[model samples]
Target: MKEYLKASSLDEALNLLSKDSQLKVLAGGTDLMVQKHAGSLSDVRFLDINALPSLKNINEKDWGIAIGALTTYRQILNSDLVLAEFPLLAQAARETASVAIQNRGTLGGNIVNASPAGDSLPVLLVYNALLELQTQKEKRNIAYTDFHQGYKKMDLRSGELLTQILLPKGNTWDRSYFKKVGTRKAQSISKVVMAALLKMNGETIEDVRIALGSIAAFPLRCRFLEDFLKGQQLPLLKREELDRLIEQNICPMDDIRSTKEYRLQIVKNLVWDFLKA
Candidate 1:
């Protein structure tokens, strides 16, 4: 038999974790429960985060939109404020697993799960979402890049629960889109996904953020590409330049989802096509 607990408060959750080294945090149970049932991971204790409603809202502040840890994918997609303001976020939320997954999967769990195929990861990366973590000792805010350490690994400590994802005040503007490649559209994991944020001045790109998923150990923003694109004339970057830009930036791998060569080619093509569009 397995031991489980439903903690109704953040303090209770942290206290429980402080006492048990093998305890697992269960928010939506979309990832942890499946992994446990599949025998990929197991725990002596389980702390269900749903009871802590304090962790379940999308708060709009003057600084930014604070996405609660327990906020579901569906909530994000359904938010008119989100759709109106951060279309990039809404765009990525649209690509998440399916209606079923979207209904149950949580934003915090997605970050903690650290899956390479997570659709929202690339979007959050582009928006510069800040990870809010809390424990009995103190609370801290970590940048998204710093929070995701590696595959299934994060900077979160045992007693430190992810409280919220604070997205900086609307960076998304008129030109931004999320593109995903999966086996099939409805309920498939991303084979490879990419997102771009562009501010163009006629034919020249003034600023942008490029992020890709399933291409590295952790999804990351393409600072190199963003830096290179600032005020660059679009017409100058043809197929070869686009290819070289991708080749110079992303270091993709040949995983079960795709070949390294294919990923490279796709990144190059997406950059060129999206910029042109």
Candidate 2:
């Protein structure tokens, strides 16, 4: 028989998790409920953590911002701090889904879902997001880049819950770009997504960070390309050099949403266009 439990407090939730490793956490339920309804989930136990108010806050720190895992996309869209400081993340949040989904979908759910096509992930990668995981015994932080070990897998332990996403204050970036290519403009899964931050010194590229999703097992940072572009004059940078580096970074596959060829070409074109502009 399927069992459901509601956690009255954070302590209660952690206790339940420590005891029952099989309990699937239920937060916003945007993805989980859909899976359950489609019969993908069977003979499962659910731990509803919606009652834990402590997990639903957005706080500013001297170093960066600590976003509670339970903070909904709606809250993110409405936060001025996010808009002014982390506009790339805010733009991704705005493009996540329709208003109704944004109201109910939590950032934590998106992270834990571990979809390669997740819209916010590339933005997080570019920002160098830190994730805080907690259990009854201890708490630890992990870099977002290292959290995903493979497709549909993460570094989370059995009893740990992702509690917060910490984003460090970004350096002064002269240019920022974010784009999500989906079947439709909104409420559609992305076929390919890219986010980039560039610090320019006159015409020379001082520093750059480029990240992409839906083209790899997990969201990827284009470190090879970033390293190649640094100190290169944008006007003189050649597409051939970029194409070579990008090819080394991602391994795309044919999926229902898009073909491998299309995804690869799109990413190359996006990067070229961003630099040229």
Candidate 3:
């Protein structure tokens, strides 16, 4: 590392970020340290914000819940508010690495890392999470869906830091489903991950949101599928139509973990199972 600096406060961190465009913010060090050791970050300057107390809180807002960026996976799993109101997120957090990694890997780190295989990302998409970004001079909020532009790319600006994630409350979902497919269930990275929220009116679908990861360049919401599924009767939903929609919605690739054909088939099966249940 060219430089390593620890920030004691949010203001100082923002100020430092404003000065050095190349300065990388280090939170949990889970991803950063790995990169550092791999020599990928050899010349990067690091600004450690682990000591900033303001970025490590979770609070309930009138509209929803506000989770600080520095909140760890363990913290999310332990949070009663999170568990009760957003169990899908809690489930994702629980399925994240082992206990030690969960304790040390912060949600902020996960979001900023922008890996398509990230466990929480599909859940965040289905939940319609919002992000709050801060700079020395200003603060702004953006929809989490719009945050990722491509693989390993984001809408985050040079001097801004992601501060909080806002998740709107959903008390009316008839059913919610989250599933991750990997070599091993607990510790392995996902080959395909899917999360969906559905609201049913008797047998007809009133509303639906679906998101998927590791089937595209970045984790993405299945907007076309959601639009098609809305107002469709579940029992009458044709498997051919569903398969077509699913294929149109995702762009899976043959990778080291799994083949594109397998990922496509698994996601279709998962969605079918969720709908049937």
Candidate 4:
């Protein structure tokens, strides 16, 4: 392990990363610290980003919502404004490990980790979140769908820092909910998770979004399921239709935590249950 520079400002951190390609940015240090302790720390300089004040805020823009990268899950969960506007996100955040982890684990780290089982990723996907990345040159906003390119891989470049998450505003998403299957409630990791958001026109769903986690290489967002239910009246969307949507959207694999068949069946039931409610 090489001795790394700890920065006090975003510019200072960018300057180091821009100068040396070997510098890796560190925020929250939840995942990184654990990896380092396990002898998996990569040989590189660490650019500490904990001091960037701009990366610790939440603001509403004229067109969208801006959530700073360093904003902890606890802060998000406790935010009344977020609860009112993005209840699905709050619901998903509630299912994360425990209070202690929520107080320290950040939104940026969750996205960067790009885990298939990240509880909040599916919620972000439902919100159509975008990432604002800052570099020495300028700032760029990338769609969340394009941000995570693969498992543990992101589209972010060297010298760039994910500063904020942008979610569109003024859209009515009623019937938004989150569900997850875990061994126990507290501090337990999920075996399968799903998030659904819909806009209703009378009894028909006008627009909808559905995302599933822990069932694929990355959190899967299937707009097709939404499309299928677009014009279907609530009374017409039978349980069989909900079950068919799940099977069509996922081909899950059995893992240490759960069986593929079980996840599929549970996901199908969750959709049916939500629609029925």
Lowest summed lDDT window (length 10), candidate 2:
244-253
Task: Give the per-residue Cα lDDT of candidate 1 at 21.
Answer: 52
Global lDDT of each model?
0.82, 0.91, 0.91, 0.82
Candidate 4 clash figure, as a count: 0
TM-score of 4: 0.94
Which 10 successive residues of model 3 have the least lDDT summed? 245-254
Put down candidate 2 lDDT per residue, 129-162, tens digits, no spaces. 9999999999999999999888989999998899
Model 2, position 77: C-alpha lDDT score:
87
> Model 4: per-residue lDDT, tens digit, 184-265?
8877677888888877888887888888888877887877777787888978877876777678777886888889998888
Predict model 2's lDDT versus the native.
Answer: 0.91
Candidate 3 Cα errors over 4 Å, as ranges:
none
State the displacement of the C-alpha of residue 147, model 4, in Å, after optimal TM-score superposition: 1.2
Q: Model 4 off-target regions past 4 Å?
A: 42-44
RMSD of 1: 1.7
Runs in model 1 deviating more than 4 A are 170-172
Report the Cα RMSD per candidate: 1.7, 1.3, 1.3, 1.7
Q: Lowest-scoring 10 consecutive residues by lDDT in candidate 4?
A: 1-10
Per-model TM-score on C-alpha atoms: 0.94, 0.96, 0.97, 0.94
Candidate 4 overall Cα lDDT vs. reference? Answer: 0.82
Which window of ten consecutive residues has the lowest lDDT sum in model 1?
A: 168-177
